[model samples]
Target: MTERELIKKAQAGHNSALNQLLLDNYSILKGYLIKLTLQKELAEDLTQETLLKAVTKIQDYEPRGKFSTWLIVIGKNLYFDYLRKNKNLRNYEEYDSVEKNRVGNQEASAEDHVISGLTFEKMRETLGTLSREKRSVFILKHYYGYSYKEIAEIEQCPIGTIRSRLHNSIEDIRRVMEEEGLDGF
Candidate 1:
């Protein structure tokens, strides 16, 4: 069935339609969550939570955008809320072994090695300085390559707001890089 048909059936309280929708979109939602949270278990849990939220709120859905986009927005909000609640939690600083091993690979040229190190470190520091909303917008736009319209729909804001947020984020990063003489990156 088409998404519109599925949505119509699901809204009418058809359990099978809802289940089919979730099953069809689960992997896409999970992959998106993984990128946002950078953890497998957290991503999986958030995916489930997103699906549940979507099911419960299915009646509110107006088919304004693709169901996948709607699902991702719900997942993103849940992840942000989780971060806000756990803001005071202790920091865990273990480096990912995969990244470390990749950095140590003999195939890396001198220029490639230096550029990668600097880019990664600068990105980490820059990301830490952005407000939650700005960072989320930037990541969704640039890192995830989502369009402004899609982001606005997901964020429940005007398209201009997403554009402004992305502009400010890029300007901030540029200023930081210039100040630190890291513009070569």
Candidate 2:
């Protein structure tokens, strides 16, 4: 069924349609949260909160934007709210979450595992340096390929603010890479 049809059914209280819509967007939401939080467990927890909010508020959903975008805005708000309430997690020092998911598949060579692990480390390090707002804008725009207008809508900020945040985020990542002499990445 088309997205609109699914949404119509979902909004009308069709459990299957609601499940389908949430399932379809689960990975997108989780993947974005992983990058944003750099903590697998916290991302998973926030994703659950986001989906729950979506389900309870499904009736309030409008078709003005993609459903996935709406889910992200909810996810982002929950994340920020979580941050405000939990000061310690905001430090981004929670390696326990990443370590749990670091195990290689049984078939992968040790060499492949090592290379990928290093890449993940660098990425997490780079992304961890930015403020949450800039990180959200950067991830939505460059990582998720959303237009600035869509990002503004998802973030409920002015387009100019989104542009500025993205610009600063890119610069922040660039500065970190150069300063660390990790330029080749």
Q: Candidate 1: list runs displaced more than 4 Å.
A: 88-131, 142-145, 171-185
TM-score of each: 0.63, 0.80
lDDT of each: 0.70, 0.77
RMSD of every prediction:
11.1, 10.7
Q: In terms of lDDT, which candidate is strongest?
A: 2
State the local distance difference test value for candidate 1: 0.70
Give the per-residue lDDT of model 1 (tens digit) for 24-126.
8787789777655656898899998999999999999888778888898899889877876887322322111111111222322432333343476577577
Worst 10 residues of 2 by lDDT: 95-104
Give the winner by TM-score.
2
Residue-wise lDDT of candidate 2 within 126-182, one digit each (tens)?
778887777787778766889878998987767767766766666676666657665
Estimate the overall C-alpha local distance difference test score of candidate 2. 0.77
